[model samples]
Target: MSLLFRRPTLTRLLLLKNIKQNQRSTICSKPPKEKIGPVQSTFALCVFAVTLLAPAGWIMHHIPEYRRQGQNTST
Candidate 1:
């Protein structure tokens, strides 16, 4: 299609505008305030810990089975 051969000036202009807006925001915007309320903070920490621990727990649970399989394969 002839449309495919068209120059991307409009697309480039929009991309450049977004980049400039981000630059302005980064330079001008204040950082978010830290949340210190105990209940919210505790809940956040618990969620984060569980998210991290789930994978670790999975790995630990699989290790013994994996080792037993390896032992059987060798013997």
Candidate 2:
């Protein structure tokens, strides 16, 4: 309880110390050596779309089945 209720000044000091010591990292400063082709970009986009939408599509497709099961179980 004492630790949880410690003075605000101490917390502020700790936060300031952390902020001063924090280091930022960049992913990359240079551009890619090779550019991605349009075909490869389109394929990548399609794969990404399928990855994201396949599960939702599966769930939506089976929603009626799920509802029927729920009704049968409740009765």
Candidate 3:
């Protein structure tokens, strides 16, 4: 039917207009200008290291199969 065809075109135009408006608002907004202090930066680095390393440490400690597979591959 003509209604079905026109409905999707109308929906598409509305979605496009909404997206353009959002893009314009973001473009007009100013980004924050801030620098991380040394203490905060160090804490962030420690958090990042723990997040990155803790899982690997847990897997190494608990998963003997991974170690066996590595040994097999290396030898």
TM-score of every model? 0.47, 0.60, 0.43
Clashing pairs in 1: none
Provide the overall lDDT of each model, using Cα atoms, as 2-decimal numbers. 0.91, 0.90, 0.87
- Give the runs in model 2 whose Cα sits over 4 Å from its true position: 1-28
Q: For every model in order, what is the number of clashing pairs?
A: 0, 0, 0
RMSD of each: 6.5, 5.3, 6.9
lDDT order, best first, reads: 1, 2, 3
Residue-level lDDT of model 3, residues 37-58, one tens digit each, is: 8999899999999999999999
Best candidate (score: lDDT): 1
Please give the range of 10 consecutive residues that has the lowest summed lDDT in model 1. Answer: 27-36
Candidate 1 residues 19-56, lDDT tens each? Answer: 99998887756677884789988999999999999999
Per-residue lDDT value at 67 in model 2: 100
Ranking 1 against 3 by lDDT, winner: 1
- What is the lDDT for 57 in model 2? 100
- List residue ranges in candidate 1 displaced over 4 A: 1-22, 25-36
The global Cα lDDT (0 to 1) of model 1 is 0.91
Q: Could you tell me the lDDT of residue 8 within candidate 3?
A: 61
Window of ten residues with lowest summed lDDT in model 2: 19-28
Q: What is the lDDT of residue 24 in candidate 2?
A: 32
